[model samples]
Target: MSKQPPLDKFERDVLDESVPIQQLLRLVIVLGGRAFSEPLRLWARNELQGYPGPGIPLPTYRMITAPLQMDSHSRFSQGRNETISALALPDVAHDLVSEQLPVTFSVGKLQNLISHQDPHTPLKLGLPGSAELARLMTSERSGQGVVVERIYWSVHASALHDILEQVRNRLLEFVAELRATMEPGESEPTVGQVHQAAQTINITVGDHSPVHVIAPHRHSATVSFPTRPHHRWWPRR
Candidate 1:
């Protein structure tokens, strides 16, 4: 068997849970820049600094789906704000409910949120077009005096932790590939070697190719809730 290269130490570091993910990401950015791999560098940069804006493709792992909730008041539940499903809005307003919420936060931001959050309380993110949805839903039942206060997604902390774990796993995979590509006694990988290894990995390259994920078959729990009557027509926003 050939002696492991010094760069192999990175594999051990990647496997260490105590090592901050941001630290590994910074190292990746440095390695990517040294290797002249734009894709690798860009990916690491985005993870550290966050994606520029909307319309940019995000990694499949960064997309998470959470239950939508809304705080509102109706004649039936007068005076008190009732928390109900944002999905309970009229069928016309259903288009506003995003099934998959893209997590564009930087790795460091996510880490900070997870660290300070209480395990029992979920982090709430304001849903886009929430105001519009509230207006539409309120107008649809104007006679009923329904007032929509807030619309947001209740995201579990574990989900954010999962994203960090996935990032670590990807780094581990890349380092392993780098190790395999290194020649005996070589301390570091060449630019060609780095590029070749990156091409084999799905997310390392900037290509927006679809990542096929096989979801485990798990039985979903049935949730019963009171919902408003469906409207045949959608009110124009």
Candidate 2:
């Protein structure tokens, strides 16, 4: 039987970070760069530098990595590694911090929120940066800005639901690509090669940078991450 992957610290961080990203992607990261009002862009233009967080409305991100071989016998198997990431939309906070968004919370919150749902709700969402952030409760979005009411969200939780759906589809690409070929920083499993394989892998969400999104009227709390530190052995280069 194939050995099960271990639950590591990064696993928790990645899941945590993916939550807000899922939200930002759904709400702020819209269909196009032109989604933002031109006036807003102009206002924020000179003052608005490029960033990874929320600010611009719609943008794109990239996760770049050049995994070095881990096998002691592989060519580029020396102790060198590289990683790259890109962000879509951006925010002020993300601009100040660039790509350093929290990873542990985004993924965790997203998974918890998506797994369960009520059949009659408006996809309840807890407000960010408040006592609610602590509660982490699943509530519905009722009423509006000034008089918003918190209802339990369940049945109508289809909004953020698609992000994970996208994630799954994207994950298929990973599975598909790796299914037939040897992965970087990876060694082909061989009965006589070695009795042991790497026991630890590192996943840096967005690498040293965090993905951000931008909006005109509302401030966007954004998040984006890339699976990092995927380690294996290649050669002794």
Runs of candidate 2 exceeding 4 Å displacement:
1-52, 55-105, 124-155, 183-237
lDDT per residue, candidate 1, 55-107, as tens digits? 56788888888877777787688432334564676676566455577788999
TM-score for all predictions? 0.76, 0.26
Q: How many Å off is the CA of 11 in candidate 1?
A: 2.3
Q: Mind giving the per-residue lDDT tens digits that candidate 2 earns over 1-237? A: 864332122233324544443432322122113333232222123112222243323211222111111111123232211111212111211232222222212333445656675635334322123233112211221121121122111223344454344443432332233223433444222211111111010111333432222334422211112122212222111
lDDT of 1: 0.69
Local distance difference test values of all predictions, in order: 0.69, 0.27
Residue 58, model 1: Cα distance from true site in angstroms: 0.6
Model 1 poorest 10 in a row by lDDT: 219-228
> Candidate 1, residue 214: CA error in Å?
28
